[model samples]
Target chain A: MELDLSVEIAGLKLKNPVMNASGTYDPLRYESLVDPNLLGAVVLKSLTLNPREGNPPPRIVEVACGIVNSIGIQNEGVEEFIKVKVPLLRKFKEATFIASVAGLTPNEFAEVVEALEGVDIFKAYEINTSCPNLEKGGVNCALDERCIQQVTKAVRGKTNKPVIVKLAPDVTDIVAIAKVAVDAGADALTIANTYRALVVDLKSRKPILHNVTGGLSGPAIKPITLRLVYEVVKALDVPVIASGGITSANDALEYLLVGAKAVQIGTMNFVRHDIMIKIIEGIKKFMVDEGIKDIKEFIGTLRT
Target chain B: MKLVECSVTHNLRVRPEYHILGLECGELGSIEPGQFITVSVDSVEMVLRRPFSIYRVFENRGVIEIFFKVVGKGTKALSELKEGMAVSVLGPLGKGFPLYEGVTAVLLSRGVGLASLALLGDKLKGLKSRVVTIASFKGRDADLASDNEYVKSFSDEVIVLYDEDRSSDVENVRYLLNKVKPDVVYTCGSKRLVRLLKELPYEAYVAWEERMGCAVGACRSCAVRTVAGYKLTCYDGPVFNVRDLIL
Candidate 1:
């Protein structure tokens, strides 16, 4: 028997249950490796209002089974993304393009969303108020309810497309931020961004990353991410797109069992360019072997 | 962008700190010097790719060799790769050193940067240019002869400069440069020596290493702005004219 693969988060229906996490995979760079049309949705790297060169060197450090990135949201800004990236992404047939935006201020966020008004390819806008990879105002915008509500309200007022707030796992109470975002008119929630972490080279007596602080992702943070996804799914009424530490289809299934509507694959993309495909295939195979039908039937099926 | 698993043919310790990893490229030998291939160690343990320069690629043998130091977890994992173990590698990319016949001189390097000149010396040799392999390091044993033998076969002379401090190594390099003055100069590593060469009257080419993304010139992360404006180090050069650089 064939297993169903269609999934929906908020009002958006995805053909499959897998997505390329924001800032993890670049389609233009690795298009030849995999068929972009086969993807459920492609979340582009974080875009700011103005072009950013990002942080200094040694931006990434590989740990024991994980990776840390302080890329600082290095992007080509909305104007360039709209001019260059969006056009190329729109050419792909089946993949839904979700543009992820990061800004220094709420107004900048709204401005970028506003600028994206008429451009047709994007299915949604991911408001990244919490990126541990950056040093400044991006994460600060989601630390408190006031900032989260304000930024969400500002962007929500400007765009007709669905806006999903990507939250930080580093926050004290993620549910509080999720409540604020839901109340402020967010369409969905991407719970638990990379947690701020570090690694020191004992010989050099200094941190490995050039920024000193970086966002940790991969298998190392899987447990924490599941807890966050579970907590948010229990607290908020909005859909939660689980991310952080998702590597395989079983990992994605684990997230779904815990209450994630869908899952995002990050650092794993660097190693195997077609991991998304493998995960998608693996999820289908699991469903077939387990005698399950539609993938959505198992969504949040985990019992306490 | 096709991801294919290839087997490691040779996995041996070239030195105390370095490993010589050879993989079967099999009819895939268009890579240039300074251009690196990204390798994946394991699907679960190491997620991100570790980039390794092309130490040498033999088209007839269908072999691609990489020389890497055990610096961190990724390198540590790579060092443990046994012969016949399957590993994934993305291909020959980035702009290599320009091949010009009758080029005056060549300067080799120490460390993994020796991989940066794998194809360069061959190109210079084909051009019938005089070359010098100046082995600069902090008291490394002379018995470590993997690619050194390949370089020696192509160069005209050899100079060994051993100093721990990089600035001191630059001064020592100046002493040798004065002795082997030539019409043109090319270097793989040693930015300090490259800077020192800029102060001299002779024209020199210094290959600079930078953090890269995509390595195909799209990310624009490895751009180094010189007097001639910004140029992507990955595509435009891992090599650049010494006088053209601002620093």
Candidate 2:
């Protein structure tokens, strides 16, 4: 039987369930290797109001099975993204682009959404709520119900497009925050962001990352993130786009089996630039072997 | 730059600390010196590809060789790679050193960083009446016969300095720079050297080494802080003008 890998969430249609996690892949750079037309959606880097220089190096350290990064979301801001990037980005006529919005405040989040609303190329917006909220006093961690509510509502008020709230997995009550975001008008939830982590230099007796602590992503966090995703998917009625450390079709399948509408490939893109193509092929082979006709029938079908 | 999954043609260990990895690049040999390639150590345990300068590429033979030192897990795993083992090799990525005809230039490098300069030195020697001088700095144990021979093939002169003697000291290095007084100079992966070169009279460039991710400009992990915001060490340059750097 001919298998169908297409999926839809929050009214946005994806040709397949594979896409690069925000900040992990660049379409302009990788387009020569991995065709953007084949990916479900091209997720760009997180954009703030103004251009950011990010943090000072050393920003990343490779540990056992993963790496920790404090990139500080260095980006060209929404204006530059619309001006410099969009002109080049428009060339990919068949490619669906998803903009990741980040900000220091709720009003700032909506402002970015408003700035990008006129851009005709974007199909959706993925909200990176991991920014340090001025009112919250620390990294939002995407867990504060009041903050998630305001950020989601403010962003929702500005655009009619889909708003995906990317949450952090280190929190005590993810389901509560996920529910708050859904109620506040988030059309979807990227079940988790990078896991909060730290690495130290034995000789200097200091942290490796300039920011001291960073977000960890790779195969190391796959199992832990899968569990967190399972819990969130079981509780929320809204769509959940899984994002922790999906390196393979098997990992993506596991997330889909747990009810994730789609999966985002993160750290592995650094290891192998053509990994998404291999994964899309791997998922296709899996469907042929399992006699699955369409991807929707296979999603959320975990055998308990 | 394209990603090629090629088999290892050779993994010749120059010493316990250094090895030269060779992979078959099919019709993929258009690269300049100081340009780098990120090799995915290809272990699930490793999260990022390790970037190495293009030591040599034989287009006819369809082979690309990378010189690396075993400083960490990535290189350690790369050292164990055998002939015919499949590996994911990306690039040749990032900017290479800028070249000019008939200009006197010096290749100054530290330890394994010498690999980044050899290809450029070879190219510089081909130009009309250009003088190529190599000033290599090594630690007590880092001095290798192969390094001397490799740089000697294209360089007009070779001056070896080591930690065993203070000849490689900043003052001595400054004195040597004045003696040669070349039109332009090139260095590799040394902050002290780059900083020193920036204060000198002649034009200088550096092949920057950084902890890289995505190798493309995507992740922004390997950022080199410049007077004009930040540039990615992997994408913007493995080679950059000394004046443009804040180091």
Candidate 3:
């Protein structure tokens, strides 16, 4: 039986249920080793209103089962990204391109969407209101209901394409923020971003990263993020894309079984560049072993 | 960039503090001096692959080497690997040192940094350039085995400095560099080296080292401060012009 790995996210049909998390994989680097078209989707690094230099040296530190990183959303400005990246992105005709948008203010968020609206390359806009490493500090959009709604509404007003609002995982109540985004205009939700965490270098007697704290992602946070996806999926009717500590297809399967429409591979890409392909292959083998014909049938089939 | 599994030929303790991990693989095509490779540890605890400069790439022998200090569990685990074992490797990563032929070049290195420059010696021999290597060590134990052999193969002159004599200090290094008056300089190992090279007026290059999540530029884990702005050490360079870097 041929496995139908097709899955939907806010009306877009993806060939597979697997896609890369924002800012993790750059296709240009390993052009020969891997192909982006093999992925269901590709989310580019978060783009701000202007080009950012990102954080200082030592942007990442490895921990037990995970890594803490504060890249400070380093990127070419939206204008430059469209100019330089759009043509390159067009190479992946099969994979859907998602523009991960980040800005300091809601106005900045709206302007980014407005600028990218005319660009024919991007299939969707991922409003990244969830980054914890910004100067404003933790959970800026998570706690502030008005800020979430405002950013979502502003972005929603500008583009006809689907808007995925990635929520910060450091919040006290993530469901509440998801509600606000959904109510305002988010077509779907990327359940959570990396959890806010810190690590100190014992030899140096100081924080490992210059930002002092960063978002943590890896297999370590999988269970915690799984629960987050579970709660959000139970409450919300909209599509939920999971992005956290997913290392293997089994981890991805857990999120899919818990009702996530698709999965995003992040830090694990560092361990092996072909991890996404390994995962997609893993998922295929799993479906064949489990006698599952279509992925949508297996998705959200949790016994609980 | 390619991922290939190579058999471990040897993991010899080349020095008291350093071990040279030698792997036999067929043709890792056209590797430059400062270009590096990342080795997968295959342990759950150490999730990320550890990066090492291509200390030596011998196409005739089908072997590539990495000289590393066993500071943490990852290196410790790698040091324990026996010969004939298979290991996954991603290679010819990052930028290497400048490859201009027939130019007089001086390699200024400190501590384990010489490992990054070890390959350049062989490359320069082919280029027929006058190469001078001035290496400084804190003590006798920190010195590498190759330092003894560099003169016969690549360098015209080999000067070894030690921290105990204070001869390895900045002022002495400055004097040595001025005396050689080479066409270009290449360096690695410590920030103090970069600080010294930063002030010098001559043309110089640095093979920087940073903790990287991905050997590819995508992860942006290895950001090096540059005069132009911040650049990803994994992508933009592990090799950069001395003038280009802010540090």
Q: Of models 2 and 3, which has the larger DockQ?
A: 2
lDDT (Cα, tens digit) per residue for candidate 3, span B122-221: 7887898888888888987786634557434777878888899898999999999999888888998978888888798878888998888887889788
lDDT of 3 by residue, A1-304 (tens): 8889999888888889888888888877767677989888888889998998898968888888888898888998999988888888777677678889988877788899999889887889998886442434554665577778888998998988999998888788888888999999899999788888889977789998898988888888889999999999999898999998888889899999999999999888888788889899999999999999999999999997
List runs of model 1 lying over 4 Å from the truth: A131-139, B140-147, B164-168, B178-184, B198-247
Q: Runs in model 3 with CA error above 4 Å?
A: A131-139, B145-147, B150-152
List the candidates ranked by lDDT, beginning with the highest: 2, 3, 1
Q: Indicate the residue-level lDDT of A252 in model 1.
A: 93
How much does each candidate deviate at the interface, measured as C-alpha RMSD after superposition? 3.5, 0.9, 1.2
lDDT (0 to 1) per candidate: 0.77, 0.86, 0.86
Q: Candidate 2 on B1-247: residue-level lDDT in tens?
A: 8788888999998877989889997865579888988888754887778889998777788898888889988889999999999988888889899887888888888778888887888888877525555454466567653356766777777777776787778778888988999899999857888888989999999999888888888899999988787999988888888999986
Model 2 residue A3 CA deviation in Å:
1.8
**Pairs of residues at least 3 apart in sequence or in different chains that clash in candidate 2:** none
Which pairs, if any, clash in model 3? Answer: none
- Using DockQ as the measure, which candidate wins? 2
Residue A221's lDDT in candidate 2:
90
Q: Is candidate 1 or candidate 2 better by lDDT?
A: 2
Q: In model 3, what is chain B's TM-score?
A: 0.96
